[model samples]
Target: METMTTSHSLRSTSINPANLIELELLSQIVTQKQSANDIRGSIPYLAKMAQIIDNQRLETTVAASSPQQQQLQQQQHTLRLLQADAHRQLGQAYMKIGQYIQAEASLTITIQRLESLLKDDNAATSHSIIVNQLIEGYDLLKECFELLGKPHMVQGMENRKRKYTTPAPAPTQATASKDKSSP
Candidate 1:
């Protein structure tokens, strides 16, 4: 399975010119280290790289305006999603290193940001894409809590997961009968 996007492809097709250089460099580092043998050893470096990308994205987002503002906002949103993915990866790495506290912190950030982005009115991205991301985020977070021996936290994650994954309730017989009568 493909695990990472190459910097070249990201640069050529998706990234805006304003974020080109920084994002390319960050993506290169992330892609190269993704399959490294010493994944736990790479957590700090990966987390720092993700932080740098997020800081740049924040600065660009704050400065957005005028005719390019809408386009820039969309690009920055995409960058934020990438940043969240980096954080999730870093969290998993932290988990491998037995750093439950750090893992929980990183995973919490990923889940929160992803949930926020999924709430955006202008987010025209695929619903399944965002939902899948949330599922991954929550799954990792639940693992982190379990490893930390935090049953309450684990329960919370489970509840959130069910909320997202469970189908809506089927209409009650009374409601169905009322509907037929109205028609």
Candidate 2:
């Protein structure tokens, strides 16, 4: 297992180039020789050790991703849940610093991902075999977004509601005429 070239770095922390290189080399040695944990002390280690963790994680993901779409789906489901939690935490952090717009954006991403997951019966419903819990999660996500208090999100929600509640407006005559002229 190895990291894919197209893998996006996580937002939790940026991997320092030096640390990434060192850790990746160490990772190779560790994997090849299956040595003891004492091998970790050889280099200038990253304080948070983000690169090492990401290296292992990226390897695992790549290996699993090579298998099938079912594997990909499961991975995506887990990632979405994790992303929601990360966004919530990030939003809270941003709010504490008075960065309300950043907070709102992060929370909105959280809420939107959760909502999308719920709507995807495959992701949410597939989690358990006995029953469909997707709708329950859907409602919870709706509440979460409302709690976040973003004006645009609320407006978007309202617009979506109206779209479903009211039928689509009849097409304009000019558009109808143009359509009729098409072969």
Candidate 3:
């Protein structure tokens, strides 16, 4: 696993990177650790990555309506998603480590963050990615509720999960044909 050698180097170096490489490396390490069932080992890395993402400042010098500003906004949105993902992974790790309360907190934050992102009209991020993250968050939250012995919350999470996992109603043949004919 990459964690064997890279983990040591990651720990030795300060992890404040202006680029995404460190974030990607941290994510890889977290995934590797989780795959090896080393949930505890991944927690600190996940926490660090989340912190780094949350603290990153976008320093765009252009006007708000400029293309550079738009790109920076997109980058900021992506960073927000990445931060939410880090929290989701941390929640999953906490759940595996039998820390239900911490898991619940992290998962709740992940869901809230994604939900807000879904409301952003200017978001360049795809709805499917946000929806998928929400589904995962709900699933993890369901487990947290189960672990915490909250049956009602578990059912609520299940319903919320279904809301995202359920496909949208397909267009009727008549409607499709009418639209095609009109065009």
Among these predicted structures, which one has the highest TM-score?
Answer: 1
lDDT of residue 61 for candidate 1:
40
Rank the models by lDDT, top first: 3, 1, 2
The lDDT, on a scale of 0 to 1, for candidate 1 is 0.77
Candidate 1 residue pairs that clash: none
Question: Tens digit of lDDT per residue, candidate 1, span 38-96?
Answer: 66556656777677657653334455467567776666678778878878888888888
C-alpha lDDT values of all predictions = 0.77, 0.49, 0.80
lDDT (Cα, tens digit) per residue for candidate 2, span 1-183: 987564465322233456557656754654443244332332123212322333433213444444555665655566566556545545544554555665566566665666666566464345442122223323333444566675566666555445334666899999999999999
When 1 and 3 are scored with TM-score, the better candidate is 1
All candidates' TM-scores? 0.73, 0.37, 0.70
Better candidate number, 2 or 3, judged by TM-score: 3
Give the C-alpha miss distance for residue 77 in model 3, angstroms. 1.4
Q: In model 3, what lDDT does residue 62 have? A: 38
Candidate 2 has a TM-score of 0.37
Candidate with maximal lDDT: 3
Error of 1 at 32 (Å): 5.0
